[model samples]
Target: MATGSPRPAVLRERVAGLMAGTLTLPLGGCRAALLDPQGPVGAAEKTILLNALAIMLAIVVPTILATLGFAWWFRASNTRARYRPQWVYSGRVELVTWSIPILVILFLGGLTWVGSHDLDPARPLKSTQPAVTVEVVSLDWKWLFIYPDQGVASVNQLVVPAGAPLRLKLTSASVMNTFFVPQLGSMIYTMNGMSGQLYLQADKPGVYAGQSSHFSGDGFSGMQFDVRAVPATDFKTWIDRTKAAGPALDEQAYGALSKQSTDVAPYTYRAVSPGLYEDIVQQHLPPAPGPVAAQPASQVAPVKKAS
Candidate 1:
């Protein structure tokens, strides 16, 4: 006789083990950034995410179980299984399937609507302390953060006072990009020739990871920055230290800085040229040559206008 297949129990055990490993493989590499948020905004977002997941799982888990239950109950070897050849859909089944989905939609819609308005990036955070204004410019492979209030600027790093709100005014020096600090929540876009506002605050002193979430070019993988949230005194000291040294960020300096480069080290500018940020937004300062290679005059495609 030919060799028989493995016993059904052994096959089931191997399949179960494989399924377990498959389900857990991705989790091993996952970071709980959203779940372990460090700011109030991030916390609120976490709540929304968990709530949505719970709502979805209410139906999902039951449906999965019902599927398995049906499969087993209707299996060929089950002697007591119902075999109604002309059975139609039952009213109870229709009611359950329709009602659950409708309820899920309403819950999800209401949650999203409330969260969107409440967490509007433009809306200022409520704080007794004044908000710090930081001008952000996304370049080809780096981030430029200008602290207009402090009269200082930094490349590839952002420093803010913990417990105080931050009002971020963002734009891009080249193609459009997104500015995101995962622990602080709210990933807003930085567009060329346009400004966007975002408000975030760190609940405690810590270093958070920030990056350009929108891919722009080859150096996109290395486009990351650090957000340092320090105490108020420390923040003031940093400003003073930064001001006492480093070169001023005049138009000429900015011009050189705008050139495409990757993995740039963090550096500070003691002073920023007056109206530089405004000029960039108003197109007085020409936008950077983006990542795209220069094409020959005859080969360049003509720009099109939408109707």
Candidate 2:
């Protein structure tokens, strides 16, 4: 395969190999998903996580070392060590113990407050590059990505410009699921009949792994997808190519695609039905009854809406 090509399996293996050499740990193999991020959002999130760990470790590490040192200093064999039977409640020790933890807590709290807002998924990224909006529907064991502007759709594959921001409007077509692109940042739940928003940006051209982090049903294990970030020119070329050769995504085709399944391969559509995503959301609810004409107040009893 070409080095600059969009080959998912090959790229995954390469990332895994890089992790093996650079990030080997005692616990298990390196997790490229969380540790090796590919975008600004993911990098920021990783920094927050590492900062929290370091803040806690500042106290934990010193406490552990002090415990060991004290054990050796107060050992029974150390006859020269001072021993006082009445020694208790030293003001210096109390001050040190309380002050260190209080400082640590204050620092962590500040960091959390700032990081949470900075990484808010609903917030749009600050950039001069244009943003691409994708409508994502989480199915039983698959993912559907619809590009309204391009009037095309894809299954289990999301392609976007490398430098342009990606705005995702997501909802579940069936049960609750999560839309996660680990290398691009946080995961958010996709609940039935409700929509969620997430913004992501890829810093360079590459392919990243995406999956449904939340388990839904029997085929949950295979609910995986690929995110391909290419150059702006290439992205436009891809859209044109799909429009020329991909299949049409009509209502019947969508109905068949939304059913429960596993390990589906990626495919594209040249066109999609208008308001298809809204239709999918509406399908989860019971159909609304036809409007009833107004009647005389004395002849008809009043009806109350369901709570």
Candidate 3:
């Protein structure tokens, strides 16, 4: 007898195994960044998350067990199970059910309220050393980091010193986007014609991944960068090396960079035009062209007035 296609049950089992493998593939070698933090802000946020989960599970787990118990005890075969035909709502049960959720709500609310102000993105982190200010600009599908004090700039790469606070002034050159580094905590928005402030710190030296969280356009998927946190001495060495090479980021160079492109390689600018950041914020250097401006207003025909 010729064996045809495999049985349905076996085929389903094979398909399920393939699907599970596919789902776990992306998570290979990946640690849960939110739960395993590298900085003070991220650790604090993780604590809140775990606390919230435990609080909810306190009520959820018991409710699930109670449901299973009731189903098994009241089953048709359990002749000893009492049936109360006239049973109305019990005050004790109502009190227990309602009080638990109310308590959970109160606890969660208080936690959020305190954490928000404590970890405000604009609030500076306390450190013995001075904070490093890096002006961040979100381009179409890239990030431009300017170290004004150091007189140097870089594209798609952010380098800072470990154990030192970071003061970030973020703005967008094109559409609005969000700047986020999961392991470092705090996500802030970057908008064109407006600037926002954020403070962060890395307690140790490591490379953290960063990206634009908000959807911008076709190239949004590739708008990723790496944050290199190094020792103070290494940070100074990097700045010197950057200053010794690469072309100056002048207006012409910036204009060219503002144009839409994706997956830009990290590069440094030996020198940057003074006040370039301020110019972009103040719109002195015109905002980058966006989707709205892709089609000129003059090209569209005007609507006629009703007769």
Candidate 4:
């Protein structure tokens, strides 16, 4: 009876399986959605990654171990090792060494290219479920989030429903800014006279860190916000209560509000004047612009009717 060796096969399997299993257990498990792709916008991209890594490791782990083993076992001192430095490489090795990486690269690249388009922020929420549209204005060193439908606005805090996609339309009131909510999605830039879009959904209800990924003026360090993902019903109630307890934000008030500041607390404006966000987007909707345009309050208009 011939006794066949199983060490090579067993070693390969054990190493590869260990590598894959440990990675998945720690980084790609079900709970991963909390800090990564389980959320709304990152789902598509994350799925591609999780799927691809699982496939790549099939070859990657084995290939790595083989490289190390080949180097060590085939040392010049080993009499059993074959010496063929001048010998030409075999076609089989050539084909495999080049082909494997090519395939991996193609698959990973394809996944990324396709995901970029599929998860575009502007893409409509195809599902019958409607997403809440949150209008965000990046201030010099702060954030102002307005819920148009809810008819309320908040400084430094954004509230939305967890597990539901959120459509964000962002622009800057003064200098360029960036809106970033880690553990939810990518950071999107905001520019004066320009607008951008970002989509995000949190899988679980939590208060996550939101900040400006760009540097602007003196208060750049303070340009941050809070992202709160909660249940839909609770979100609605939050909006209602915020509106009930806050004061209205009119054009004049907004003009004053857009100035640079930092270390802000959450505050709500009960009634936002219609088109307040649009006005901020336009930049010309302010009370006055240049020094020439600015006149004393007494000179602009009389308190009484000008009949």
| Candidate that scores best on TM-score | 1
TM-score, every prediction: 0.86, 0.82, 0.85, 0.74
Query: Which sections of candidate 4 miss by over 4 Å?
Result: 1-38, 55-60, 286-307
Whole-model lDDT per candidate:
0.93, 0.87, 0.93, 0.77
Q: Show where candidate 1 strays beyond 4 Å.
A: 1-31, 294-307
Write the residue-wise lDDT of candidate 3 on 10-60 in tens digits: 999999999999999998745778877899999999899989999899899
User: Model 1, 117: alpha-carbon shift in Å?
Assistant: 0.7
Give the C-alpha lDDT of model 1: 0.93
Positional deviation of residue 1's Cα in model 4 after best superposition, in angstroms: 70
Off by over 4 Å in 2: 1-31, 284-307
CA RMSD for every model? 7.9, 14.4, 5.3, 15.4
Off by over 4 Å in 3: 1-30, 292-307
- Can you rank all candidates by TM-score, best first? 1, 3, 2, 4
Candidate 1 TM-score over all chains jointly: 0.86
lDDT of 4 by residue, 45-85 (tens): 66666778877996889899999999999987889988877
Residue-wise lDDT of candidate 1 within 1-307, one digit each (tens)?
A: 7899999999999999999999999897456677668888999998999999999999999999999999999999999997999998899989999999999999999999999999999999999999999999999789999998889999999999999999999999899999999888999999999999999999999999998888898889989999999999999999999999999999999999999999999999999998899998998999998998666668768799998
Clash totals for all candidate models: 0, 0, 0, 0
Q: Against the hidden true structure, what lDDT does model 3 obtain?
A: 0.93
